[model samples]
Target: MDVPADDDPFEAQRERASNPMRRLFDEYGRERSGTFAVGVAASVFARVLDLLPPLMLGIAVDAIFLNESEFSLPLVPDRWLPTDPETQFWLVVGIVLFSFLGGAVLHWFRNWGWNRFAQYVQHAIRTDTYDAMQRLNMTFFADKQTGEMMSVLSNDVNRLERFLNDGLNSAFRLGVMVVGIAALLFWMNWQLAIVALLPVPLIALFTYQFVKTIQPKYADVRSTVGQVNSRLENNLGGIQVIKTSNTESYEADRVEEVSGDYFDANWGAIETRIKFFPGLRVLAGLGFALTFTIGGLWVFRGEGPWLFTGTLRPGEFVTFILYSQRFIWPMAQFGQIINMYQRAYASAARVFGLMDEDAGIEERPDAAELVVDDGRVDYDDVTFGYGDETILDGVSFTAEGGDTVALVGPTGAGKSTALKLLLRMYDVDDGAIRVDGQDVRDVTLASLRDTIGYVSQETFLFYGTVRENITYGAFEASDEDVVAAAKAAEAHEFVTNLPDGYDTMVGERGVKLSGGQRQRLAIARAMLRDPDILILDEATSDVDTETEMLIQRSLDRLTADRTTFVIAHRLSTVKDADQIVVLDDGEVVERGSHEDLLATDGLYASLWSVQAGEIDDLPAEFVERATDRGARAETDGATTDQ
Candidate 1:
């Protein structure tokens, strides 16, 4: 299982976008092409409203200055107005009210449209990313940490949300503000307009450099944050281990180290901002001073329009200043928006990388449903590995209908890997596994898995009631059926004694239950499934000897009429098995019936001797009882022989 290096070309291109804010817009572009159109329209309308205040000021100045040049409709004749000045004053008031109402309406529509688009895009991305996670294979989960996945689903998605809610629409509106103000200034007086904009290029240059310097820093901050989160998640999941080993201090130190790295990363980003933002503020101040100094002097000296007509009106200067302020505010926000976009881009790259992973096991286009009849399973020359080291080397085995075959091996001897291959958790590197004489690869994954019931050494129970955990596989099972399954697995007594009986909620991973209880519950779950093929991978290894006996009895009944594959270290558990295969170092060293393998003096004999010696080493009372049972069996055998 050499994890392949990611080589997506588009990943680099997406990483290099000048405005990660634009990427947010592009993500929106996926669902409805009309989102961008609506967004743009709303932004333009909002900007138009922003420009109205300046225009109103300019109009008011004209009304106050030249008596005959008062603000009035050019298409309307003066004779249509009332003779009194008071009547005309009311008309102007009505006009102002209408303008305010119009602005309010545009504001409502703009916010409504943009927010709707943002939510739609967020929903689409979340759904798509979740689906992509499901489609990925075990390899992806193996390589990726759980915390990093959580970060993508929570933090990264929230980053995108922030961009949509404010950053994207704000940037677009800012651009509109800049362009509209520039146009208005030019229309008023071209020379003054040029003077007002003289410092804009310098402002933009400063912002670009500031953002560029901080972008990589923000990426570092995000990475360090992810590392810190991973540490916390790992520690929390293994809290019991830490407590048992008295390693809380060690765990805390590790977490502190990661936290310190995060602090440094964030400080580095802040340092960049500390230097760049001060310079940006100074640049803005200089622009403001220039606007006031140059524009004021020009008006005071009666130049161009002022010199040709009269002194510059107070209202006009006020209006120009207001427009100038509007332009500058967006310039200040420009750096902040770029900062946000850069962080989002880094997050997006990680998220999309997960979404882009290719599943190692994929169904063929023409794959068919697995049809189970005789329950025959075959492993043909299977060679498999997790990485460079091989786990199963040209291994071959077959189990026919109604046969109980046991695989006994040392740790990491590829027993569980063989069973996983049958379930197609990972495809064999070089060989085929067949169910009912059909290649498992050619059968649909769902159908293949449905035919097999597996109970592993590690039992995973979700957070739910006892009844819910037992019926996890067969959800439609009636209460009576569930109880029957539990009885078969020897879990009924313990479950009935619980505080809530069937309704007792199992804590995370069934942590509240003892080891033996969890194993029994798992067996009960498998029994409910009632698959034709059963795999018990060290299922009773975690339980006490007393509990193991009960579980063994349940398993004996369950495997009586089915094909079973048992992987275990306890040799006594499989002495009655139809056949036993002894595996060591990725190859089968010996395999036969219990009595025959013992006579061979091979691996099985060596393992059986060790386990039998342990059993014989028990207390004298237990040994005497076993001897009495053996004598009784021999007496019965002699009578039958006669």
Candidate 2:
């Protein structure tokens, strides 16, 4: 089993970037430029149109109602306006109607464009992240949980979508309103505009503080989310085990602990966020209150307040109040926008961090496809390990074409590890493994693996109908061929008896099937694969003696003309093997046919004698050694199983 990494509550925080949003824009912005451009245009149009009614209202108040100001508009030529008051009233009504109608239409376009951009970008991010994650080596995956990776694809990716949809849209809309209102306010009266915008720096400072305070909290929330998901996934997957072990309360405690962590983290961010938004409104309200007090005095006295000298018309004061309030709302909303942006930033960092994670192995650009010629496999002085402990040392062996070579050893003897090297699950540390005189690493991984068939003690089946699982890798296998393969593996009887026969659904990981049944199905799948070379690592370890005999008969026939390697715990299973190489503590101690090894009477003979119920025939030194080895084997077996 692989060692698990310690849980880091600040794991996502470590990936914090200065500008992950910029990275997101760079990667996917070009792809969705069409929708993004349209969305931006619509936001500009709608927000600008929203300012029209206020502008027209101010003009109508002065020119039409009180006649305190001339009938003048900002951009229109004076000659274009009507000379009489009645025509000016009609013109204001028409402009207001157009503003409302045009704004509604643009709003629809805004929602459509932003929604499409968000959904498409979210889908692309998830797919790309999953692609990057799945291609990483087993070593990388060993320290990761499935639920943690899924959090990136699901929670983090969906968070980015929300930011793109609501956060980005709000940002554009508020930006237009703030700019448009400020410009209009300044144009109407620059002195009052200065007084109204007094709280701008304070708002900016408060927002910066809010962002700084909540950034780490959001990261903690994201990290805890992954932790909670991992716990749930692990518990749900092993529910059967938990029930069998009567650990319901134990599992519940674990769930509660992780969930509690998430709650605390999320609430911390929520607390900060709640305080920030209302605090911004108060700061914004300061500007609104200041504008009201000063503008009211200016309009009442017909003079600017507090040393300012200007004729303050009632309509201009009214326009300033309206524009200043709009500015306040946008300033307040900047808090909400920043909130979403921080959340999305943490998620983006995680998504990009996973994408940037390094892989353990890489294929050369010039790697060639492997073509089998007799499948002559060789291991010359091969050595490998995990971490610092050596699992295999100076191991050398060969299985020439059409030969049946058996690797027999106790548990943790590196038998399975040795076979994995052929598959390149882990590369050798010292020497070379070649097939047909070509180094396994020199060829493209796909072609090399495609030519080798492997069946191990632990069998895995995807959730699907029996037929689908059997034909998994060999998608083109005919019904006749599938039935033939099942029959050959002695699985046809059990399969036909299952409910719905070959069409029966196997639950996740094939939990619906028995151990022997799953093992047999695995054999049938390998038979359908029909590789030129085969590696069987304890393939029959789970089956009954009767089933093993039946499978052995089929295997005997299947390997007649193909190169084969077998690793078996039950030495009797490999008695007929052409060559039996005995491994003890990673070194090959005995090598010969069954009879030849027995005559030498070494570790192999001691093991054979003990298994054959001839314990008294062994010497004292060999007896103590055999007993110790047996104890070690059992201990190792239990460890491996766990």
Candidate 3:
């Protein structure tokens, strides 16, 4: 659970989830066990059958061609063997052909089984990982980049598929080949078999070194991929700003820097890997060369040779050479297997780490569906903070059913944060927010959120038709209802004027539409929700004066019978509220009707005076408030720059 310092990125990142590959199998592989078993079984069967051809060829060479040894197979009974040499020859040919045909069939099954297993696991992991990610609290995403998560879902997952398909397949096939071939080699002649296997221990030592050295390098490479992706996504999303500011060269330089980091990290891993694979081939070639030289001398002398003393037949010597090559080939391929495994393990570590992120919004086991009777909302001494900075503290207010209460405040007065708590966006550090005497935390999140509608200052619209964005949450809304909601938000006129009307493509983030058009659509979507409580956070702040009046009229109808909490900087929007709560620095500064607050000559009255074009009549207290806000802005700007 410990996070490393920024200076230590990969060494600790690789260790974030220890034995992640094992955990991955335990979590996702059990369900695909049947396919996995099939792949492994087919690979074992195919490799075993493949070894039979070389053994049969050796037998035919000696018994039929040279006639130096009798015709026999190790497992077959001697009586089953034909006395006719020509018949034995045909039998060898038949067995070799069957081995090829049978091995071919098994290899086909192996490929199918592995593909199914890898694809199934890939699909399930991606969907499940994404589900977990989306359900995590907003604070998790606030600290994460969209591209980093995309890398996990795309690049990291595809690496796992390759490892599972290629790595696991080669591992199983080579394993069986090495074991079956080694057993046959020693059976023919133990002394020459020893020379063939001498390189195995060296191969194993080199493989271990390769894995140890390449693991962190691969981890570094994976991290750099995420950074590069993050940089690209950030730049592309803000391409407008870059173009307007003419910062193309600056942004390109930043991209090149991150891309260079990726190249460096990848080349480091490639350097280690390329060196290891060739070293393995060398060891394999060494073992094959040693086996051929020793076996040839023994065959030439027709007697024992030095430390290796044995009677080696031309045919048996040929078989030993063939089996030794097979044995060493698998040993050589072990390098590739280890290389793939290290990459997969690094990717798996990142994936499992993401899955293991704590889901901050958890429903209590005994939580029940929320039922709104009167839509009465109460903020009773509610307090919340992020770390040491309290956004809202000891803020208490009440809006009885059918009340429209406006929250007016300075920029950092916690106006929006206070309303968000009513939706249970974050749990209160202390005290509670209740609706109809039910604690927001004690109700199911879905049911609680279903009873509330929100229209934020910053509107979000997915790339879709005008109708699709309206019915986003209300997916089953009829055509009539969609039109009525759009009419209610004053969006019908602009939408109908568009080329495609209801079917128009909004483009990414609704970029094709103007800000006013997007905000009106957001209001329409909220109207379709038809919740017991409504939140309007600067809903009319972005529209023109004419559009604002039109939307304001619609909002009056929208908030008529519902309990509405409006956060607005424009004092005109809330001049007719049932009650106006003015806040300053995370605390309530005033609460009253607009006319009554103006009579008090406090912060609300001052903010109203400035917005009302009463600049010459600004009170001394208003000037002080402006000075404090300016100071806060500067401090925040400095922190952002750092």
Q: Candidate 1 deviates by what RMSD? A: 9.1
lDDT: worst 10-residue window of model 1? 1-10
Candidate 2: list runs displaced more than 4 Å: 1-6, 9-19, 609-642
For model 1 the TM-score comes to: 0.86
Writing each residue's lDDT as its tens digit, candidate 2 over 1-642 gives: 111123643253345444678889999878999999999999999999999888888899999999998999889999999978999999999999999999999999999999999999999989998998877777666667778877888999999999999999999999999999999988988888998899999999999999999988887788788888888999998999999999999999999988888898888888888888888888889889988998899889888767889887887778788889999889889889999999999899888877777656677788999989888999999998888988899999888898999998766678888888899888899999999998998999999989999987899999998999889889999999999999988889999999999999989999999888888888899899999999988888778988788778777766778899999888898999999999877889889999999999887888788789998888898767657867976775653410
**1 or 3, greater by TM-score:** 3
Q: Which scores higher on TM-score, 2 or 3?
A: 3
lDDT of 1 at 468: 97
Task: Encode model 1's per-residue lDDT on 1-642: one tens digit a residue.
Answer: 111123222233235444444555565555665655676787787677657656665655566444434554434687675544456556655656666777677667667766777778777777877888877777567665677667677777778777776777788888899899888777666666666777778878987888778766766676666677788999999998999999999999999987887798789888888887677667777777777776677567755443333445555667677887777767777877777777777767666665566767899999999998989888899998878878889888888888999998655568888888899888999989888899999999988989999988889999999999999979999999999999999999999999999999989989899988998898999899999999998888888889899988888878878899999888888888888888766788788899999898766776676677745434555446446746755774531100
Off by over 4 Å in 3: 1-18, 616-625, 638-642
lDDT value for model 1: 0.76
Give the TM-score comparing model 2 with the true structure, all chains together. Answer: 0.92
Clashes of 2: 0
Please report the candidate that would top TM-score against the real structure: 3
**TM-score of candidate 3 on Cα atoms, chains taken together:** 0.95
Ranking of predictions according to TM-score: 3, 2, 1
Per-prediction count of colliding residue pairs?
2, 0, 0
What clash pairs does model 3 have? none
